[model samples]
Target: MNHTDHLLIFEPEMAGHQPLYIRLLYHYLLENKPTLKVTFVVHPDINKRLVKEDGIKLQTVGNKINLVFLNETEISASLHNTLWIRAVNRWRLMKKYLKTTGANHGHFLYFDHIQFPLALRLPFLPEKKISGLLFQPPMLDFYGDEKNLKEVIRNYRKKWFYTLMLNNTALSFVYTLNPLFPSYARKHFTNGNKAYHLPDPSMFPTGDINLSDEDCALTKHVGENRKLFLLFGALTKRKGIFEVMEALKHLEPEYISQIAVVFAGKLEAGIRSTFLDKVDFYKQNNPNANLHVEDRFLSTNEIISLLQYCDIVLAPYHRYFVGSSGVLLWAVGAKKPVLTSNYGLLGYQVQKYHLGISIDTTKPKLIADAFRRYLNNPDDYERNTSGMERLHAESLPENFARIFFSKFL
Candidate 1:
């Protein structure tokens, strides 16, 4: 690893769970390959989740990585909603960054975000070697107001459409974070050795999580005789949080007092108010409902601590959610099992990894039945911890970085 190879991870626009994985991978590459000169081009605006130091410590080493923040690569109030404009601005910034770094003919570039309409198709940039991690393929998306008939047609067209889309890109390799991506989606990439399935390692909980499980207020609800089941992360209808809460109400009274359910994460104002009303109803009828809510986004330390506190993570996701669940993986990282959806990528990953129980989350009775099952024998799900360490080893940020650069470059 010399001047002959340079790895550039272009991540100027942070969105979704990118911040969580970016932080994990950044620290991994930093610790594992200290001498490797990697350039990290980040967004000018600082996000604490992406770059925060616990206490007053500075996370950046300032030597291995050349942090180039573009001042003009941003969208303001008037035209901020337009994706095309912002993407183009970031695109312009990327070209400028390559020039500024004096990147040579065969340097490696990884774009954390997938570009659109005018996508980040690097075939045009032949001088530099390229690799990208696709967080969402077109097949993972469903259009607005699409009817059931049209949706069926779209699902059929999407695999072919995605295959063609990636086939045309001149990238040396394109990796999908989801290993369960429809096999037919890429006839060549899967079979021709062009596309790789990089199991997403985005769920690494922040530092020393197991050390402070007793320090968090959330865990206090999990008494010696009680088991804790958590519905963590942002609250939304798509995540099946409402249905989960409703299911909690239907839990048998004996089970209700024995199991504590927590919904923790930032809730939109309307959702928060409605959630409180529902909780109030439960409280008025019987405190045995035992539901607690921590309605705010969690910090890195808090997230890890919360996961450690949780006995079982609930990811009863909507079947329509095509991608994987960060919450489910976070639980896996904490060596906990999940109660999740039985359809789509989330379920596939859960089953593939043997991480938890898959349930038809759309039905409240099914959810309640699943909860009863988990309570009957939590150890059944806990047995899946054997593969997690190996999964993390392969998915370590530096390992992913090494696999692409060492093999391709």
Candidate 2:
């Protein structure tokens, strides 16, 4: 009930995929009817960068949430190290913090499965509750495609270790954004000490923003006359970047000329060369088909601007488990129709609500056809966007917080 009730959130990385959801959770807890105290145990790399003078600001939405950043060492010594070493290192760092904190009767929220082994090892304060928040699996099935046989074997071994770590957690809370992984999670947490299917926080919005004079000018400059199709988030192999590129290849040159694909976020090393090569080929072959790639990290406002101006959003993940996506949520908040792959729970939700079209990413023809349909039936796309907005309004962070707190706290 008190703000000092102590909720520790352990995460390996806070910047990219994790922070948005964590921020939503932080605000929700703070804004709850009976406020719950929360402390975020962030990775050292994230904390160092975020706590800097020009770092991310931690402000509660309604003065209901309080954020304390506890820094932990990175999972790897170097950026391009093996994931196994990183997982082990992250667990060690988190374990060190948990042992020193000495908090009693509070809650421990593990954001990733890699933190679970260390969390379970901690000597918790008597009556303390431990809850695991699983965003996705430790290793994705498609990741193996990007590696050699030996490397794939090594990855799977590490994945097995991570799976065991997850099994040892007190309660596993899966954020089901993709519908495909629920059964996998259910099977993993079969004993069921505590396991709940919580929707991803992307389903909720912070609130509407009124454009200022300068903001209007910038929006008009960046987006005016541009039929934007946004693919926000890290450009990686599993993200289905190649699939989207292939889809674009199938589009008629004239039809493609009318649209622009805007990609925002950092590029992953695994597929960087291949992705860039494809992008280069497309640019050379089709000068009229505009492909705007922002190689740098984007701030929140810039992302919001893209969401606002974009006619359609693309979430073409090739192989993914059902979990929430910040991009999808942002599109919903911005009232933009999404064209996503029918691979996970996100696709299920989109189809269920008629909020967007789900295509088979494996088939370039289907992906191109989906886009053609959207272009031809602009009214249908608008209707889908409106439906997404309504769905988002119904699943506000406050409402979702109630569900999370009721189940965990």
Candidate 3:
């Protein structure tokens, strides 16, 4: 009967920010809307991680909350590895589950994955209300000054894709993490289905800063006198870790000795050995280099503790990563300075908010120069404190959940 009273949330991803994002919505629904029944369809990995990793007691949340794990066979690639194909397959699975569960409303917790198919105008079930959160939308203009032919063509294609997705009658709302997206959506793509900007939530650390044994070892390796520069969360070449390393070579021995670098997250699969080898070679060649690596999954508390323990947060992502960054928010929440990329939304926020140094991170020399500036006199950049509090306030989880859910639900 009253299908609108029930909400079905489908999230096939468990890595990165997926678990936290789903938990935020679940808790918000539980506490804010007591009568709303929820059914969470997630990857089997979520079952293993929900309670143990995130400390969420599903049984205690309420009787109205239900957990359903996705069938791997249903959403699996089955040989096709393309993103749109996988997105379409996931869409099919969600539609099937929506019908089976008899819920008229569904929400995609990680909507970016489904966007490819939606952009291509895939068949969405008629009359079913759907909402999704978008993290990396290509429609946003990331390259303003340095636009080549390929970049221009890509932006136009993605803008067209946004138009197609926004015009879908079944889609109720599209929420983006970038604050600039809503105005862009209004000016460019006019549709009854609203596209709104949602603040990327920041979970500030609480209680005592207790470092894990591995983290303690990292702290010991870096020592106490040197300024710690942290590159956190899913360490990969794309995150500009190697560029930061190469930038080290340009610094003098005294500068290197005064600063320490830590890569404190699981390295992307297959790149661990190569990264470690480079670290080893750099250490061997420059004994003054204080580089430490923790190539493993870090706990949430450990990550926050590391954030508090460090002097500066490093988010030197390449220009290709134009979306908002959780690391940037965490650094702001922790009131630490950052050396980030001057490319897209992330760069704009850093520059606008005086969060830290935003440079062209693709160049090692630029990164080194930023490091030098920070090393020279960190207090000189205390002017970066102006907008940190405002950004942190806007990024609270309650604000994120409220704005997103209030849109259509």
Candidate 4:
């Protein structure tokens, strides 16, 4: 192996949702196969931050990895103007970058969903060896309580463009987190020659964080004897934060006293009002109860510490379209018992692996009862921990490296 073949990872923005997985993938590739040159093709806005803060650099990792910061002229032209227009312009810019890069480099792997506007615009470029890796299907619809016609139409349009782009790919790999997504992708794309099913990378544990005793100390003052049920993710309605708060209201006072709920994540702008309203209502109704909400992002060490102390992890997600979540992966990595809803692939994994208890998001009592069951039965909690440990051991970095190399590398 000459170690000169390059992998080009294209992501518009390197913040929120996808970056975590991308970071994991970057490290996995570098550590597992040191010879291959990995070049991250990010938009100008993302490149600086990803390099400085996110630590996505070749030399930093003590390897000869390359990070190419391709300036997106089209995105810069339409940003702060209109999203639809911006997407169109971004597609043009991305196509230009791909064409120039592809001509210079003989072979490259694109680590993005098949539907990015740029992928659709790829017809303009000369044919070259390009592999498309799908983390999530672009056309998958997210169903929730919000029923605005305009929003619905916007989502459908976005999906339509994605479908077109994915169908035209040279080589494609669908990383299905849920069974439903793969079937949906296969049917919609209908490109058997290019597509294959790949599992979500989140299932593979990266590594264990070395947390000091002081670092693991609870954010809120914990009395000598107390139990805590923690929920950590973006505090949005779709994430079931409101439902969790409602469930807490019905719990008995004694149980409430023994329990504390810690919410750690940034709240989405649209749902900030709803989130605050629920928090206010909960506090007004139960003055003595402990409800700790950390509204900012936490460092990896902080997150690991919080996970270590959690009695039970709560992931009462309302949407079924999303296949896997980094939050759930973290809980599994930390060996904490999770109380997640029967949503999509995550629910399937929970049931199949016996990782934790699953509840219906519609029923608040189910969530409360599930929490109580784990709180009351120490043996059940222990059993769940054992299962999580086994799962973790089987799906760590080394195991994931083997799978990736065997299939793709």
Best by TM-score: 3
Cα TM-score per model: 0.74, 0.74, 0.90, 0.74
| Model 2 vs. true fold: TM | 0.74
Residue pairs with clashing backbones, model 1: none
Tell me the spans in candidate 4 whose CA falls farther than 4 Å from its real position.
1-4, 28-36, 43-64, 70-90, 102-122, 129-166, 169-171, 178-190, 202-209, 376-386, 398-409
Candidate 4: how large is its RMSD? 5.6
Q: Measured by C-alpha RMSD in angstroms, how accurate is candidate 2?
A: 6.0
Give the candidates in order of TM-score, highest first: 3, 1, 4, 2
lDDT of 1 by residue, 237-308 (tens): 777888887887788888887888888777755577887888778877876667788876665567676677
Kindly give the stretch of ten consecutive residues in candidate 3 with the minimal lDDT sum.
71-80
Q: After superposition, how far is residue 361 of candidate 4 from its true place, in Å?
A: 1.6
Worst 10 residues of 1 by lDDT: 105-114
The most accurate candidate by lDDT is 3
Give the higher-lDDT candidate: 2 or 3.
3
Model 3 CA deviation exceeding 4 Å by range: 1-3, 50-54, 57-63, 78-80, 139-145, 206-217, 380-383
lDDT of 3 by residue, 1-409 (tens): 1246667888776557767777787788777866667788877766466575556744424556778877668536411367677778777877887888877788887776666777667777786878888887765456334766876787787777777787777677878897777777777787723777888999775346655675455566667689999998878777998898889989988899898898988797667888898899999999888898988766666777677778999999987777889989889988998888888887788878888878889899999988888889886454356599888888998887777666544
lDDT of 4 by residue, 264-367 (tens): 87777778877877888888889878887777655556677788777778888874344466677778887777788665565666776676776677578887
> What is the clash count for each candidate, in the order shown?
0, 11, 0, 0
lDDT of 2: 0.59
RMSD of 1: 5.4
* Candidate 3 similarity to native, TM-score: 0.90
Query: What does the lDDT come to for candidate 3?
Result: 0.77
